[model samples]
Structure formats: structure tokens, C-alpha cells
Target: MTSPSTATLHPIGRSTPGTEWWRTAVIYQIYPRSFADSNGDGLGDLPGITAHLDDLAALGVDALWLSPFYPSPQKDAGYDVADYCDVDPLFGTLADFDVLQAEAHARGIRVIVDLVPNHSSDRHAWFQRALAAEPGSAERARYLFRDGKGDGGQLPPNNWESVFGGPAWTRTTNADGTLGQWYLHLFDTSQPDFDWANPEVQEEFRRILRFWLDRGVDGFRVDVAHGLVKTDGLPDHLPAVDGDSMGGDSDDVPYWGQDGVHEIYRDWNRVLAEYAGDRALCAEAWLPTVDRTALWVRPDEMHQAFNFPYLQTEWDAAHLREVISESLRAFPAVGAPATWVLSNHDVVRHTSRLALTAENPQGHGIGPDSPGQPIPEVGLARARAATAVMLSLPGSAYLFQGEELGLPEVIDLPGDARQDPTWFRTDGERYGRDGCRVPIPWQADAPAYGFSPSGATWLPQPAEWATLARDVQEADEDSTLWLYRTLLATRRAYALGSGDLEWLEGFGTDVLALRNGPVTVIANTGDAPVALPAALESATLLIASTPFAGTAVPADTTVWLLAG
Candidate 1:
């Protein structure tokens, strides 16, 4: 029996051979400002990425997912989009983006750009018009605006906090000298939430999707995918017992994962289907559970969603095993591929995160005074092991730029130099994400570490990153970069991206032995080494995260074994 998805050429998706290309593809995330700086403007532009496409192609990723490069005031580090149809001069022109896409396609790699339809920068043309127009006019109707509560309208309409911090609603002033309505901003004040109930808003987004699709983009990595619509009459969000106001629970939170989001993607899917290729949409929906997350990726909606369950699981073997089991069951039930991501522009680098015993409180960004003392050496070991096991699994994997070089979070960044809006919004209580977004180190001693010819970078680089520079790692086979290249090559060659998962019995609870097709992946997370059974010892050793050539798997290590 052929399902409708397989019956067709592709499911509004990514078709390379017969399978949807994104199902098993390795996608690399490039944070434009932190990637490379081509011009001498102390910032990274599209041409900087264009110049480094070869490096990504050599790394064996099937595609590259770019962070937002759209024109903006950059209030939220480009997440606050001022214009969807053009590129920001700080990044590059649309012409430069076209060149990069053409070059990437030429190298057989797909390009997926960040699509931020959840909200627009306050400086956006529509929002500016909405401000000038009367409250009941069509222009004002495009934004989420409501009169304040209380007799004098001095109080906010609702008691919702911003994702960054503080009140979610900001009051607006009219042509008169009096304060008027309050507008919702789930994130920063500069990013005003859109009125999704408006048909004009929906049509505008559909047009934006076609604008990028017509430009020959392979797909879109939707930002805040679950936040397309708020519940009718935007209610106050009451926190759970554990104090999770957002994330894989908190369904009662009126601003996220509403039923209305499904309809938006379904319509987007139809628009994608109208294209020639397997143009795809990957959702970043953070729902209450893996089961809930699966809803966003159903055949008629998005093709993939980030597997936060796997990334959120601690370093403990028992906990990880359980999460992996649940994810394998949940995603398959929906006929959608699960995406594995260890780090991204928003989170702390796993090189530091993997070493910490304590998890940061939800919505609390870790900064200079955060808990958990990070042991970099231990972190590097665990990061390598964790990535090896993640890549060997049967799904899409996203590699954050600089993960290949084993980059640790720049925890000691100077407070005076910090730029993340969370830092200011929280009055420096939260360190925010500026640390993990520093520029890539290309040379051990080149000016600005070869990030640009000007020897200038938007964010300062660590002086000690000389050893982790790509040039230094390129020559060392034991380098994390080399290991990544090897891992990617093996995964592609064995077609492990679309493999099946089956756990091998008899191994201790701390010893994870899972078979993905003919490839056996074993990870020993206990403090003691675990000996492989006779069957696996004789099996060929495809690769190991650590140095090993024995029948026993070392502690905190992962190995991929090829069966005869």
C-alpha cells in the first residue's frame, strides 16, 4: 500500500533519489554574523558565506540552513525582521544571496533560509502604517493591538511576560498626547506580534513564501513555528508547578502551539507543492511532548521538526536511552523524520553544556554568574561521544557552525561588549546567547583569526582559540573537524540516515547498544568500561569517538561497528 506522500514525487519535500532528501540529510546551521566576515565592516555578509561554501561542501552536509539575514534594526539579532523581501545591508544584498544560493546548488548542496513570520520588527512598514492609522482601520488590524485594561487604560491588557523578560505588552501612543492601545510582543518590544486571524496577514506570508521559493531556495527553517497564532482573545498564561511558562508542556499558554498553527502550515504546504522540487518546511515547534511535537510534521504540514527531547536529555545513559526510545516511536508514528540538534544560535554550545551537571532553569539564559562549573576537557570528550551517537541514528542531524571545531561557550565575554537583548531586558541578570555566537576561527594567528581581511569582528574572539582554529585542526586527524568529516562520510555511504533502530538486549543499562541496519552503535556512559559481546567484537570497527581498538568500549565513548 503506497501512502500519498510516497505515491507522489515528494511530500512538498526534499527528493534527492527516491527518499525525501531531508529525511536523512545532514544540515549545517550558519549564523551569518558569527560565520565569516568578507568585507572590512566588522560583520559577516552573504559573500563571506559564499566564499566558505567549499568548506561546508567538504564537510559532507546535504544542505546549509542560514539564520535570518533580512533587513532589520537587529533588535533581536536579526530575529526581529523589518523586511522579508530583501536582505539587510549588514549581511548583504539580495543579489549576494542569489549568488550564494546558485553556488551552493552548484555544489549539490541545498539552501534553507530562516523564515520569521511570527512577528515583525517595530520599524517594519506595515507596523509603522498601523501606528499612524486609526485603531479600527485595516492597517491597525494587521497587528495585535488591544485597548488597555482599567478605567484610565493604564494597565496592560494581559499579564504575560516576554520571552526575553518583562511585560509582553507595550503601550502605544496615538496622534493625541494620550496613551492608547497596548500591542503584544512575545519576544523583544521591537518585535511586534502579528494578528494571524487577519486574512491579509495570511496572504502576506504566503506571498513571502513564494518570493523565496521563486528565488530557487530549497526550503525554509521556520522561526517560532508554533507561534503563528494566539488563542482567541489572547488569555493570560499560567505557569505549571515546575514554573515552565513555555516549552514541551504549558499548552495552556495561549501564545504558543495553538491549533491555528496547523492550518497555516497546511496552506504553506500547498504553496510548496506548487513548486517543482521537494521544497520543504522544517518546524521549530516546542510542544509539551514528543507526541505533541509530531502533530506539526504530519504529511500535509512540515516535513521535519527539531528533536529537542534528545537534545534536552541529560548526559545520563539511562535518561538518554528512554528519550531516544520515545522519540523513535513518536516521530515514526507521524511518518515524519525527527531532527537532532545539539547546539544552535540560541543555546549554549554543547562543548560546555555536555560537561555541566546542572541544567539551567527554563527561559533563564546562562551568563557569567550561572551555576554549573564547566570542565572543558570532560566537555570535549562527552561532546564527541554524544555527537557520534546522534549522527549514527536514523534521522536528519543539524550541526551548528563551529561545533566541528569543538568550540566551547565563551562564558567569560565582557559584559560591556554583550549585545543580546535578553541581557539588557533582564538588567544583566541573564547572560543570554552572545557567547556562543562569536566569529569562527579560521587561522591560528591570522588577523582577526582570518575572519576578515580588516582584522575586526563584531564580537570579540577568545585569545585561546588559536589551537581550535580550522587551519590547525585541518592538519590533525584526531581533530573534531576530522572526526566530523569521517562521521558524515560513513553515514552517507551506509545510508544510515534512513536506517531502522533496534536495541540489542543483554547489555547493562549504562551500556547502550543499538543497531541501525547493519551498523551497530555502542555507547558506554558508565564510569567503567563495558566489554562488547562476542558478536560485536568480531564486527568491523567503522569509527569511534575516542581512540580505541579493543573489545571494550571506554567510558563516555561511542563507537560505530559495521557488521559483516
Candidate 2:
């Protein structure tokens, strides 16, 4: 295939007919509460997102992904959704969502909403009814409510632990003040896992899918897409492995990446196909392998799954080259385009995470107080280079909010302001993800950095954000924000997305070089500059993560060359 014409690189497939926009689109993730606030409530709402639509349009993204804005007790942010069909009052009414959708479509941008099917808030009406009903009653069947073990059922049902921390099961008191059965919550006690084994549970999600699709939502970002279904029986778990905090490479876990989850997506895919407009589903599954993750997008299931193995891999060229090559190889077998990402709300910002040395790689938790953290400048430099590398690859890409502005995780959040359940459950031992979820900066001088007119932010913003604020960065040509805008425009001009990647060799052990259509992207991760190889010596330079001298590629930099 030739490089995409400079015209809008349509996600609605240049190679095939119909709306497969998701196949190669660059989707921006908006963490609603932190994106912008229009009501002076110090929290972002649907209308706030609507107000900022033009800014996103100017950023040149093809789609906007809103993290859950559903009504909830705020137990696990919006992930513990209490209502799936309506907008949370904290955000706005369904009518407000309609305006946001209409405005976005008017700008030629698609909309995808977050769908948390793996679990529901403990306060959900269904969960409430389950609590009031008897153990074997149909009301309790929607969730994984099981009898406790040991005398008088005092102990939990099994040895499973919460991904946030502590025991996964939460024992409840009966309506009559008696010790009742325990329910499993993979994350927090207030977020109970649904029993996908129940046909009613599966049917309810189908109805939910139809409700949103009917509202013109382009698709759903399936939360914990690998976790809807558990093993046949609620079984005991083996001791957690070194990297098994949330997800890992193990295949036999009782609740993760089960074969049953694919069936659930296959069913959902049928629902998606019924709607026109190239409706699609993107799974947020953290399966152990790229091949295993590819199963969710096997033409009959989700159209795309987050390429987290790429996200989790260390910042080294050989490792990166292997991941890129294997990912490109694995997805085509399933006829799906690989999705690339750098960071999200749930983890430390890649800027900070990449700063860590190999000896102190991060796990589930990170904060300013963490021992031996790397300097901020070093992390940001690597992050900028990594972003360039990601955009040059084949398939779709998802950008976490504020990444374009080079936002680093807010590590200095005070202990009093910590809200992530991981922090509370672990009893202050772990700082949790609140740092990454801090409100983003939009204006260098405006109140709350222009995130809110009231100058109040839900999560505290660090004082250093003044320089990285969007307005400040947008004015500086050498800024990270400018680099992202230029990168996106260059990618579209070169038609790099959704193309075949041919690995090019002889650039040295620390340099990664690949040909995506007419574009050749070279990334140097070595400690010193390297002379450009003969193959790329005469290629036209399109863009680079950092300025270069003559034919030498600077250390920790990525450059895009237009090949003849």
C-alpha cells in the first residue's frame, strides 16, 4: 500500500469498505473529571468535554474516549459504576452527553465510551437487591456471592486477594443483622464482580450495549475485557507471582484471560455489527501474551485490544524491536491491527516510569516518596522519544490525556489527599494511582491552570505544572505539545498508521529501524550518537524526537525519514 494521501487519513479504512475507523485511528482518552470543568464545580463534566471539543479537534485526533462518567459512589473512581445507562450528575445529564456526541461528530470525530462490565458498584440497585435477598435468591445470582468458609463462615470464600490490596472477598451482614455470605470483588469491596456464568448477567450487558449504540456511541472500551467470565467454580488462587499485581503471564489464574471471556466478546461483536457506522469494540484486557491478547480481536470478537505488553516492556531497543515485530506478526493472524499506548490513569505516567533504572523497575505503586526515583528531565526526554516511536508503528494508537503536554505523574500528593483505594486498602504503604490521575494543566496562569474556572481541582496539581500547561506549551515550537501535533500531522501526511512494518537491520544494537509503508523510523536508545546507516543516509527527514547534527541520530531519539 502507498503512503496515505495528505488528506485526512481516514480510520474508515482506505483499503476496505465501511466504517472501520478504529482499525488505524488515533484515539484520545479523556479522564472526565480532570479534562475540563464547565460548571465551576471543580470537576470535569460532559459539557466540559463538549467545550473542549475544538481543542481536541485542533489536536488532530480521530476519536475521543471518555472514561466512565456514570453515576457511582466514587468507590473506585468511575470504574465502580452504579448506573450504566445514564450520565452521572457529577458529569451531567444524558442530554448533556447528547450535546457532546453531536458536537464531536460535527467535528468529524468518533466517540467511544468506557464500559465496565467486569464489575458493578456495590451500591448499584442490583447489588443492593442482592444484599437484601437470600443467598440462593435470583437477586443475588447476578454477582459472585458465595458462602464463606470455616466455622460460622467467618473466613473468606477463598484465598484470592484484591488487585488493589487485601482479601478479594467482602463478607456482609444479613438484613437481619446476621453474618451473611461473602461476595468477590477483584478490585475493591464496593466493586463486586459480576457472574458472567449467569445468562441474565450476559443479557443485561447486551441491553447496555444496545442502549449506548442507539445513542450513536461509535463503540465501547471494554474494561477488564479479559475478566467478564471466571473459571466454572469459584476456586482458590495460587500465591501471587513477582509481577502479578493486576495481570501477568500466568495462564491458569481462576479469573483472568479465561477462554470464556472470548465467547462474551464474540456475542458482543454480533451486537456491534448490528449497528452501522463501523461500530467497534476495544478490549482493555491485560492478557499474558500478544497472541493471547490477539484472541479478543479475532474478527468475531473485539476489533482491537490495548497493546500493553508494548507498554510494559522496558525502554530498550532490542526488547522494543522484538515487541514491535512480534506484535505486527501476531495481530495479522487474527486480522486485527495492533493498538499502541504509552500511559493511562491507572499507572505511573510513562515519563516517570521510564525514568526508573532496571534495578528499581516499578510494580503496582509509585510516588515521589519512592526510593531512588530518576530525575524528571531524563524521564520526559525518553517519553518524548518513545511517543515518536509509537506513532510510527502500524495500527491504532491510544494517547492518555496530558501525555501530549509531557505530564509526569504527580508523585508529591500529600497523604491526606490520597483517594485511590489501593492506598487506603494497603494502609498508606502504597501511594496508589491518584498521582497519575491528578487534574491536568491547560493554562499557565488561569485558575487551576484553566482546568476549572473556580481554580479548584479534585486532585491537587503540582506547582511545577505551570510550565507544562497546555497554553504555555502550545506557544513554544520546541515544546512536547508541538512535537505531538507535528508528529500526528506527519503520520497522516505519510499515511503511516495501519500499514505493514518491515524491520530494517544494521543500525546497531541500541538502534531500532523499521519501514512502515514509505516511512522509515529509526530510534536510538544507546548512550551516544550513531551515524545514519546507508539505507537511510539519503532518505528525506520528516521529523525527529530531538534535533540532530548532520547524519548522526542522537541518543534516546527517534526520527522519521520519508523513503523514496
Candidate 3:
């Protein structure tokens, strides 16, 4: 392994005329409330993000995808959107968002805003009006409001479980103080799911898309993309496994990946295609297979869907190779580029998750409070290696905020400090996602790690965060931040995005070697260093997760070589 060299960096990828920038673009995911707080109000806002645009541009990302900043009571953070068109006062005004977009675009970075079409906050005016209206009123028809199963409407409409926990249906009280209709909420009770069967619901989202597109957004990252349409009759479905788990393979999982959802995207796709600048839609759909996931990105559907299987695969060479091959083969059939991601606001940070035992691979809700979890140091090594491999692969890559600095899950937040509904809903059996949502550390010595001047953060930062602060990492060439910067820069230099991936042979089961364009990416997933195969031994090393001294690729490290 060798240290990254000081090479003048190029942009994420070179754009030719009529080329779709998103096919190989590197998009950074910004969880608004935790990214940067410019108002000193203890929350990250649009202006805060605007203040940091230069830093993001320097990071070499091609676009910025902001998680919802919409008006909300925040029962599920910003996912419970109260107003689709307005910004939450806590985050800033709509005017602030425009400035953020302008600033990001000015720096040659595109902006993709989150669109939560599957549901809306119970506090949304439409949902409120539904509560005031009669059971069959037009206002109540916008969402999934149904009669309960039992007499007197005491029981829930069905046995469907919420993704957060508990029953998916919640009984609402009418203005007269009597128990009213039960509405469906796949997530938190505050997030009422929409009835996609309604024409008004479908048209409302079209208007919303035009509203944001008219405002100059480059694209949208669709939340719960597969969940727009449900099975007819809202049938009762109880899987043999934990029904609440995401990305199930069973077709019996009633609410996910229904055939009708494709038609909705096809309609949405037409609206996006009407706009200039290739305004794309990236689906957050968690389907079962690479082939199935590719359907969301078919010719008339979304442009890209998040590759959760790649993100969820255990740290193994053969498993990774198979996923890469499948994803590459499947997406090209639809003429869409695959999207890669590691950490996100909803899951446990990869660095922390990879440190855990392989049997429980996903880091979704794990935190410091979880007993017997492995230390962060062990995971940081593999995380660095894994990121190098992911960035080198053919596709667009989504980077979670602070992942460049090797931030781990802040698992130690006090019980009362937690806000994720999963904790309360599951009766503390699950710790929830508050740990990974901790504000990113920027300045090592600054209060609240420089996330806000007021030193107020919605989630507490661990003391070890000071060592992993961006400022500290920026000054160190061997830092994880440097690795990411170098990797992105190198990936661009080689123009390896959306290319054929040919797997190289003669490597151990723990070693993965592949060629894309003129560059070869090799990874050592085992505990011991491995010698490079005959073809790569003489190749020039471009960048590596660790310092290279000889022909050996280090344990848990990935290296890129210039093809011979």
C-alpha cells in the first residue's frame, strides 16, 4: 500500500455533449438538520449548506442530494413533510433553498431534492382537512382512510405493521371527539400514506414535480419509490420472516414493489423528460434482486435506483464481485446506470457496521449503546477499502455526509436523547438511527465540533469525533478524507464510470480483481496481505487505502492500478 499523491484534481467526470451527467456522477447526500447550521439555531439549514458549497465543490462531488427540508412537525425527522412547497422555518425559508441551489449549481454541482410522495405529515393541511371532513369527503379521499375491522371502529383496518414499528393504521378522532376512520401510515403515525389509486393524488405530485423543476432543481431522489402504489383491496399480508425488514424478496410483501408503481414512475418520467438538463429521478426503492431493481430504471421509468444489495453485502470478495457483475449486467439492459451507496441517514454508518460480526451485516440501528459491539477502529480499515472499491466501480456513487472522514455511529447517546421512532415503537429493543444522524464534525477544537456556533446539535457527537474532524483530516495526507478525495479524483481522471467491468482471475476467494477501461481495481478482503497476480504486479499503483511498499496488497485494503 502507498500514500495518496498530491495530484491536481479534475472534476468528477468529463461531460460530452448530450451526455447524461448522472450516469457516472458522484452525488453527496446531505441530511439537512445535521449538515451545517448557519443560523446558530442548533439545526442545519439551507443557508448553512450554502455556506459550505465551496468545501463540497472541493470534495469533487458532481451533485448534492438534500434530504427533506420541507415544513414538518418532524415526527420522523423531515420525512414527515407538512408542506411540499415551503421550507421548514427551523431549516430556513424557501428563499434560502433557492440560494442553496443557485450556489451549488454555480459551483458546477447539480442539486437533487428529496421527494416524499408516498406519504405526508399528519400536520399537512390536506391531512388536517381530511380529519375535519366527513369520512367519504373528497379531502379524506386523498389518503388511505378506511373503516376499522371491528364494530364501533375500534380495531385497526388490518394487521399491517409500520416500518418504524407497531400497527400501520392509526385511528383519528373527528372534531366531534368520536373515533374516526383509520388511516394507513407505513412509517410513523404522523406520516399518513397517500392513496395512489386517486387521480387527484397522482396529479398533485405532477404539479409538485413541476413546481420544483420550475425552481431549477436538477433532479429528485424519490423516497420510498416502490411504495407509491399498494396491492388492490389492501389485503392482509404477514410474511414468515420479520415483515418489517426492508428489501424483502417475497412478492407477498404487500406494500413494496407492486407492478402499478412502474406506471407511476413512467408518468413521472415523462414530466421530468419534458424539462431540460436531463432532470433525473433516483428511486430509493428496496426491491429483491438486481434484475428487479433494474425495472425501476427501465426506459420509461426512473433514471437510477439505489443499490441496497451492494451496500448490504458482507465484507467478502466473491460476494462483492457477484453483486458488481449482476448490477452491471442488469442496469445496462435498461440503458440506465447503476447507483452505489454505503451509508445513509436511515442506516448505521458503514465504518461502525463493518466492524460488527458478519452474521449481522447491516448497521441500520446499531449504536454505542448496543452491547458487545466492536470498536470503531476495526471497521474504519475495511470501510476505507470498501469505499475505494465502490467509487472505482461503474456507476454513480452516493456519499453520505461525513463518511469521507471515517465517522462512526454515535451509539452512546443517552436514551432520552434519541428521537428515532423505532426506539419508542419497539420498546427500546431497537436503538434506532439517531446514532448515524449525529452532526458531522468539521473543526476539531470548535464547540459542537463546529457544526453550529451555538454549540447545539440535535444529536450528541462522541468525544472521539474531535480526532476525525474534517479540519484535522484535511491536514493529514494519509487521512480517510484524503483517500476519498484521491479516489474521486482518480476515478474521474480515468473516466471509469459506466464502463464494462471484466473480472480478472487467479486471485484468492478473499481477493477481488477487476478491470474497467484502463484502470484495474483490486481488493484484499482477508486478514493477511496478498501478492498481486502476474498481470497487476508490474502495473503502476495510482491510489490505495494504505501505504504500499511492495507487490503485496494489504489486508482490508483496495488499490487501483494503471493497466499495463
Instruction: Report the Cα lDDT for candidate 3.
Output: 0.86
User: What is the per-residue lDDT of model 3 for residues 433-487, given as tens digits with 9 covering 90 to 100?
Assistant: 8988999999999988999998998888889989999999999999999999999
CA RMSD of each candidate after superposition: 4.7, 3.9, 4.4
The CA lDDT of each predicted structure is: 0.86, 0.85, 0.86
Q: Please report how far candidate 2 places residue 404 from its true position, in Å.
A: 0.3
Writing each residue's lDDT as its tens digit, candidate 1 over 1-564 gives 111111222234445533778888899999999888888788888999988888888899999999999999998889999999999999989999988887788777889999998899999999999999887889989999888899978999989888787899999987887888899998999999999999999999999999998888879999889897888877777555434334555666788888989999999999998897788899987776788888999889998998776776777778888878888888888788878888888877888888876666444555667788688888888899999999989889999999999999898888898999888898988788898899989999898888988989888999878999999999999999999999999998888889888988899888878898888999887878899888777889988998887689988899999887
- Per-residue lDDT for 1-564 in model 2, tens only? 112122322234233542367878999999999999988888888888888887888788999899999999988889999989998999999999987887788788889999999999998999999999998999999999999889999999889988888899999898779899999999999999999989999999999999998888889998988887788767888644435565745677888888888888889989987776788799888867898888888988889999988988877999998888889989878888999998988778988888876333223557666776867988888899999999998789999999999998887888898889989998987788887888888899999999999998888899998999999987899899889999999888777885778888776999988888888888888879989877668888888888876499988888888865
Question: After superposing candidate 3, which stretches have Cα over 4 Å from the reference?
Answer: 1-18, 240-244, 358-364, 369-372
